[model samples]
Target: MTQMTRSAVGGRLSDDKRKAIALQALARTESIRVLAERNGVSGPTVKMKTCMSRG
Candidate 1:
């Protein structure tokens, strides 16, 4: 698998912050792709964040 650069990893946001943002975005957006694009992150990353937050 390809590795993400630090910036591409959304390092500016802490895990807690990322989860909060992901949750809010997931609630408001129809597509994870669009939310990830808007937040400068990968869709799988956002999906993982949501899953992590839940579990």
Candidate 2:
């Protein structure tokens, strides 16, 4: 298998900060797709971050 580059992991938001931002976006938005697009990240990533924050 080919090795993945660091950029493949996505942008430089830290775990804590990412969770904070994702939560804020979720509160203000109704759609994960819109939030992800606005935040320049993937929908599943935002979902994962939000879920992790809740736990």
Tens-digit lDDT string for candidate 2 (1-55): 1113222443676777687656875686568767666566677777777777677
As a whole number from 0 to 100, the lDDT of residue 1 in candidate 2 is 14
Which residue pairs of candidate 2 clash? none
Off by over 4 Å in 1: 1-7, 25-28
Record all residue pairs in model 1 with backbone atoms less than 3 Å apart, i.e. clashing.
Answer: none
User: Each model's TM-score?
Assistant: 0.64, 0.62
Q: Where is model 1 poorest over a 10-residue stretch in terms of lDDT?
A: 1-10
lDDT of 1 by residue, 1-55 (tens): 1227524567677777797766866586568777776677777777877777677
- Candidate 1 lDDT for residue 49: 77
Relative to the true structure, candidate 1 reaches a TM of 0.64
Query: Which lDDT values do the candidates have, in the order given?
Result: 0.69, 0.65
Residue 7 of model 1 has an lDDT of 47
Please report how far candidate 2 places residue 40 from its true position, in Å: 0.6
